[model samples]
Target: MHELWFGAFLTPTAENAHTLMRQAALAEDVGLDIIGVQDHPYQPSFLDTWTLLSVLAARTQHIRFFPDVASVPLRPPAVLARAAASLDILSGGRVELGVGSGAFWDGVAAMGGPRRTPAQAVAALAEGIEVMRALWTPGGPVAFDGEHYRLDGAAPGPFPPHRIGVWVGAYKRRMLELTGRTADGWVPSSAYAAPEELAAMSAVVDRAAADAGRDPALIRRVYNVSGRFSRLAGPGFLDGPPSLWADQLAELVHLYGMSVFVMAPTEERDLKIFAEEVAPEVRAALGREQRQAAEPGTSPSATLDESSRPRLPKRDLAELSPAQRERGMHLVRVHDGLREELAEIRKGLEQVAAGRGEVAALRSLINRLTMRQNYWTLGSFCASYCRVVTTHHTIEDERMFPALRAAQASLAPVIDRLEEEHEVIAGLLTGLDAALVAMVEDPDGIDGVRDALDALAGALLSHLEYEEQELVEPLARLDLDV
Candidate 1:
């Protein structure tokens, strides 16, 4: 597995499954290390998880895919052993499975299956890991006479080429012990586990791994940081300005040893806003600071954007007198659409989070809200960028270009670059839609969605400002022709 693996957990609905695969591919395209799917039993709406992963493995060439955390009790060790082995083989050795004591109570109970106490669940998980490892090892037939499950002469053939990392998900002392003793890595749910709790869990796992004669350095302590991306309000709000957000993220970096940050933006529109408005600043600022350690003796000034870096055209659109009226109208329409869509996403998220309805219903609502927000945020900037670029194309082709060419041929090179901007922006729109579809069906897809947004925003913002600058001079000259 990568040094720090990060993935989104997704339910197994058909729409969500397909969405998750596409999102997984998109994440890989954007440099995210891993993709994760969620497993649940007896939910008529939920798809089969291992099956979904098999499909994802077929579709994605390089992205690692896994169950963020598989609830161990639902699948017996022998059965899962084969499934995981096959998936690893099919994915060309990119499958990672994280097993945990079952977390969803109602799903377990609804199947008329017995739900183990937390202690019992933890014990079962440990025994389960032993069975899986033995079955995955080709040298011997595996047998486990354990309390929760018993396997006699079980064998899963042809082991993974490398050591398959098994992650034990836990928070309690005993669970941490199980993680240290048998598993390759440890991931504790951040739902209610504080930093202090994480520190304690890390200590327990380290001690146990060492006691078991396993390399402590092989174990990874993964923590989840959940946050929202609603319209940042007030002066002191942490979400605003990339510099400020980077400063805040520094706390997570320094304290958690967090190499992977899984961001769950609160609303769909906010995701785009974050990608466009917030992500770039933070990435540039914080990413530089983190790399400073590796590149010792590097001055702070060296890290800053140098003049050699292409700057956005500093000229104002107001100087383009001939096209000012048309450009202003186009911008107003684009801005209005952005505001309306943003409001809708915000309102929907706030309602779902408020818990006004039944608890179960609220869960569904919240999931939808999160998914919707992820999609909206993933797509909004793309949509806005598309609108502006398409409008510019129409204006240029129909009116401005004709007028400019008749007046002076000197502006052709600038026009050519502006045309290139159109192609760049179109490519971004295409990529953004693929990313947005992934997150819309599965909230967990937001990890990929965020990265896409970050890349798209950087490109879109640069293109928008560049095109405007490239055209401003030509248009100013057009005022005389008009």
Candidate 2:
């Protein structure tokens, strides 16, 4: 199976031009994998998706770009293929194609694009795919004649640096079959097709692939999701905490084969929370599940025995003020980010072992966790701190643990155990950095890196859970903000 990908679905609003640029940059800064901009050329208030994407490509070094779903009627298939290939070559192969048959008929009419019925639109989409692939291929002049899209002796050149996935946005049976038979990926929006609705849709796609003698696993699944992040649980998808978002997203992956989750952000904060908090939690949970499925009785990830860990008395959150409860929830959010960091570390190690890793991934992990303190993953409140380890002691022992100890003297043992775990995790991080450098020098030393990763994962995941378990309620109960 392909690795899970997390990204943001940005709408290119004319007024939010600057915000759009900053958010694109932020996605890369926060270690997100890709960015998708909705295509709505008819909307006067929105910037052209391609123009926005080109500017973003120049602004950012990493992170990918794609039109969420281009209107096939508006963008001629041959021209669209050239544009995608040109950008992919220019951006070092960081582009993908998302095409839909047609939407907003009046807008298409205004733009001088052909208006077609649903059947004709699907037919056009199929022909458009043919025209695009023909143009993308390195061959002589291509000729095609279909019901809608037609190409007359079109020359193909300026090949993409890498293979660009042709992702189709579809919901109906005909479109789904086309996706299963011909498309490289499937793109669906949660707003239109909710998570529960996708299983049946995917079944159609799979059956079509089987009937067409194509492997269904070859077709990548992408979802354009949207929702809010609240401290309290609500009755819907992505309606609660970062953990809730992770659980729901992970479920989407396991059940419906959604490898790519490009969320439409409700707030600017949603972008950061999605990348730093939601993505990693989902990756970690999915990884844990895979490991468990592979080995039933032996699971190294479950290193800590929760039954033996120190626990403190809980309090009723209903009694606390909203602000007080929010402070505790804030800690949970920060802890979620740290958990994400560990997940990145584990993934990086696995990639290196498999000979598919990038040095950037390893460097990012080592640089952030060992060399310097990134305020977001660790804690923004400890901005003055030196590094993760330095901040851990200074922020936790000097400030956090002391406050909790002073507030509830009965919880001394739990606080002490957490502090010891912090020290343990710090040592494991130091070992991880050394292992990374050693692996760089000797390829065969990857086992050492993997060993280091297993130890760190065991220690860190257990520590974070223990810290949250003992501290979350106490933080809410106490008047102090730690």
Candidate 3:
């Protein structure tokens, strides 16, 4: 399976231009792989998707940008191909194109673009892809005549810095078939298609790819998802805590071969949590699964050691006392606060990286703070965050674990493992602190600091996910005072 990728899907509204910019910057700083903006040219309040993406590309570095799914009716294939290539070149090859057969026919006609039936739209999109690819091909004076798109002696030049992938936003059978046949990737939203429906849709795409003599794996799967961050587990999908989100997304990768998850979060806190807590946990869990699958003669069941794994309490929420449920909610809230702090630390590291010129410079003319000042600020922030995490872990070790063990003898082994993991994380945090100090002494040590942070983040996030999965139900069932 491909390495899992995570991104943010931000709304492109003219009314919140500053907010959008800040979110894009934060998405990059938090180590997200991509940033996708929705395309709806007819919406008066929304910014033009391409224009907004161009601005974002100039403002941020290292994060890929895309129009979540451009409306092909309004965006002619010829012009769209050039725009994508130009932006990809300008952004140093950090661009992917997500195009869709046109929707909202009335809006397309209002914009003086073609309005076509569903069949016509799909046909037109296939031709559009051919036209774009021809234009992108090197040493090409393309000559093509199609019912939807025609080109004669159109000299193809100004190729992209990289092979820009054309991801199709497809759902229906015809569109999915076109995606499998012509597109580089498949883009779908969970809101429009439920989890249960995904397997059927993927089967359609897979069959089409096979029919087209294409390796299905070569076509990427990118999902646009939306969910809530809550204390207690909810009935619906992704309506719970960070661990729930991680588990669900990881399952998608393992089962359906969906490798990229782009969260559409309206709240900034959700974006932070998704990037810092959820994304890391998903990566770690998937890594373990992948490694286990690679080992010869090892049964998947044996890999997890189910005998020692913590089980959810038998009682449901309705069976738990009100006070116990409240305590459980409190624990989740505490974790949420820690997640936010972790996100801040990650963002601080990104700022430090930017200040040291480890990342490409922003295309801005405004004056900014000195590199030294930025470094010092980041060091201070890291120190504070480290202290908070350490203190939180100490409290859990001294009070919560002991109380839980006393209340439920069966939880002893789980508590012991949690405590042991705490010690390991503490050591990692100390290593991070040392690295930060070294960076302070020598500015060039930013790379060392980043390496240390990556290690710490990986270990800490995995620990957090495991702790939550094992403790949330038990905490809700027992009324132990911390």
Using Cα atoms with residue i matched to residue i, what is each candidate's TM-score against the true structure?
A: 0.53, 0.62, 0.62
What local distance difference test score does each model get? 0.57, 0.75, 0.78
- lDDT string for model 3 (361-420, tens) is 573222234555677788888888889889999999999998888988988878887777
Q: List the candidate 3 regions with Cα displacement exceeding 4 Å.
A: 296-482
The weakest ten consecutive residues by lDDT in model 3 span 297-306
**Residue by residue across 17-123, what tens digits does model 1's lDDT show?**
55656555655554454666666766678778787778777776655766767867778777887778767655545777778788786787787755888888888
TM-score of candidate 2 to 2 decimals: 0.62
Query: For each candidate, C-alpha RMSD in Å?
Result: 24.0, 19.2, 22.0
What residue pairs are clashing in model 2?
A: none
Q: Best-fitting candidate, measured by lDDT?
A: 3
lDDT of 1: 0.57
Candidate 2 runs further than 4 Å off? 295-482
Which ten contiguous residues of candidate 1 have the minimum total lDDT? 298-307
